[model samples]
Target: MNPLFAFDDAQCRSLAEAHGTPCFAYSGAVAEAQFRALREVLPSRVRLAYAVKANPHPKLLAHFASLGASFDCASIGELERVETLGLPPGRTFFAGPGKREAELRKALALGVRVQAEGFEDLARLEALAAGALAVNLRVHPAFDIDEGNRIIGGSGPSAFGVDEEDVPELLRRAASLRHVRIRGLHVFAASNQRDASKLIAIHGAVLDLAKRLHEAHGLVFEQIDLGGGLGVPYAPEESPLDLAALGRGLSGLLARHAWFTGELILEPGRFLAGPCGVYLARVMRIKESRGTRFAILEGGINHLIRPLLTGEPFPVKAVGRGEGTIPYTLAGPLCTSLDRLGEVALPDLRVGDLLAFGTTGAYGLNEGMTHFLSHPVPPEAWVD
Candidate 1:
């Protein structure tokens, strides 16, 4: 559980030497293992759509596809990524707000399942298609969690789904549309939920809503895309995603809602890929100011951007097996003073030593930039 030294001892040396510092290292086997764990719990009726935004690298997506997993794309661009990989149309789902008209047209053309976020999107899709457009309803699940602590999707006044009270009317409206087809219901309120009961409650609520939608509209659902937010461990002692509990809960829910027959979809982003990768950086300098030790890394917000923008902390560990204890605040190479990674209690540090951060698989690479300092983009390696 020591994130600092969790990988195969020999493999760590191999990665450091070959990929160099400040690079992201991914494990293909780890990714597959995570997928397999979840797959083992659910029935064959369930289909996992690896949320591409988690790690959209071509190789990563290709690996998921090989594991017989589908994809959950938030935009046409993400959909196009899956399309290029030759995944089947029905296996891919397009879900998110601000789905433009052009994007809807493209999704329809490609036969990708659509989860309409708002009434405007539903109306637009209805107007464009000649036949019932394969659609999913995103319901705004009531969550008992804070917004700032949660990720984009769940709870906290999310603009992602229709209100529960309006769902029946929404389905009625969809039924009225000659070109709109409502096939599934989706709900995702938050990610990184350590509480298993919250997820279970969310899923149950979604199923309950699905039941009402079905009864009210006579719509037989073919899928229920429980938008994935399975959290990965960030702290060294933190447990990895509790797959056993999630699977059991989901299975129980399916049994409870036996009347619904269709694929059970999960769009997991962090759970699959977060622990499988590490962001490496070389210490450029060690300085002390105002009683604070600063370890300025070669890469900055430009290279791995989220922490700076959101003030959220990512798990970090120093490489090279240092044993001494010291406290230091890590900062990116960006000129802006705000580009901080996080403060960590570490031993004596030296320049050129490699530092790796854990649980950055979700947004570290895919969402970083080359702005400000514009240091050369770091390289990446995928391991089995």
Candidate 2:
């Protein structure tokens, strides 16, 4: 069975039959294996913080927590989810562009580290912090970011972190803040990048940027967060990221940058969660419009919208159906014409034939427009 598809045809059929069509099934074993695979390759100084935006399934969170994984939370909801894990302080991080006061308060109460995106974040956090607090300053580097798909929106303009050029001014103003101290740096400049060499290049640039900040601004960093863009294969043809090479590159960076003794942080969402899931939906009907062959599934962008947003389809297969030369345009039950999963070549699909989408564990139902059509929400089965 292909590694991309967490469940085989037999398993897919079982999951569809057990959980009903248009539902999702995730393999706990696969998730653990993926975490261990990356963890084993990483240097001891590197910290793996599982990004909660990927899949906030309670069971998944608990499982990761049991494996001694730290969490990277973006919103109050994510923070709350991680809070339920009952982990100690310093294990959870709160990071977002526009954090509300309530969220900041909650983060402070929980002792979660905040990734301050701008001077405003620093000010807000300073006011909320009781005593001394350390935060990692998220920097939008001026360097060009090579992305296959525009997820983070490259270096030109973004609403995420403070721009690299404006860092000095921000720091100058932030020095006035009494409670909030910038002790670390965070740079996220890659998206869905599979090439290990390319990832290393981006990481190297971030470290170089950090070095400049340390030397020029006198900023001492205890942690440098290289934001998550770790890529996973969505198709069989695409190569998986070389974990060994990535590990070696990071180790090499540490060796080169001997001045920095702080731990490197990697927040991986999709890479850690994407491979462990399979979205199962049965073909509701088959339609041939003009020259396009359409296989309308029980679900569409409502359950998995990554394809619609990224123009890249998740690897899908017809359950129990062998490979074929027939082409298919997978559609959903939505009213809009834009509710397309992808156009791909699959075996001859029939009505009620089960279709399983692979690599959907991350941005599957959690990221979908489930409330759009008032359709019954699909149940997600966590397979052990």
Candidate 3:
């Protein structure tokens, strides 16, 4: 835990009392700190585009914008948020697999940088740009980016990028399109990877490809967009991310690409905002049977949604009128057994006590539901 509750104990308690159970609390300081740490590591040559899908709430986006960070949008709605926040199109990069033509048209109109996933997207973008937009090629690298098949792509097959063998033809096609400028290249491997070595390997591959492309086509890439899958420590014993290593690796790669003419781009989502927020749920019931204890929280898969769906483990801490330490099974009040957050060892959990779950910041709120008996949703509080 980042001592999230330590910052504003009274306010957190008040918010819980007023807003009822199943609320969210986010720390502005943590968010800003993460960005600052990233700035320290990111090469001076690259432009940082914070991926908005991690936490798209307007206030958070505005905070990132104020820090001079750019935006990476996945959909038209996200693009509109960028525009509405008053961030210029040049500062935002539009990237998503299977983007609709409407979204591409919006991106083109906004004059933002775009990433084309395949040959067809290139065709669609060229047609839509009508002589006005440029895009990077999103390449699916040859690696086991994901440990399992849960994510968008992995080793065997993926639908998110052009094949390595097809690069020349894709470039040839881009060369023909007068309106669409092929400005760069991109590779997004996976999310929540703990080992920094894996990231280094992945970036090494990206740079190797860039070097080959430069040699073959007389193409000097202005920008190399590396999609972010930076993971935050969700387990209590895990160490914080080694961003310094990532920075050194990335900087070295860009240094080798002296032929590249434009800025370097990084689209990081989880690293920027995932650990900044904590989910607060009220214990509705506590039961023990056959040497097992369960602290059933008021909210289920409906409010804090990702755990049940992805099996990603998050840490849970007992708060508000609890003892020092105890082992208990933490579960949501939902009927489905899988609605359980996980088996957690917390300090003396009791009915009606508040339980704070760590690292719920990335996918928790946005992926939550209002389904199953239509339980009222909780309020979100921003903390300093």
Best by TM-score: 2
Candidate 1: worst-modelled 10 consecutive residues by lDDT: 1-10
Clashing pairs in 1: 22-280, 22-281, 154-189, 154-190, 155-189, 326-346
Best candidate according to lDDT:
2
Name model 2 segments beyond 4 Å from true.
Answer: none
Count of backbone clashes for each model? Answer: 6, 0, 1
lDDT of each: 0.77, 0.92, 0.77
Candidate 3 lDDT for residue 203: 72
The residue pairs that clash in candidate 2, if any, are none
TM-score-better candidate, 2 vs 3: 2
TM-score of each: 0.92, 0.99, 0.91
The local lDDT score (0 to 100) that residue 108 gets in candidate 3 is: 78
Candidate ranking under lDDT, highest first, comes to: 2, 1, 3
Candidate 3 shows a clash count of 1
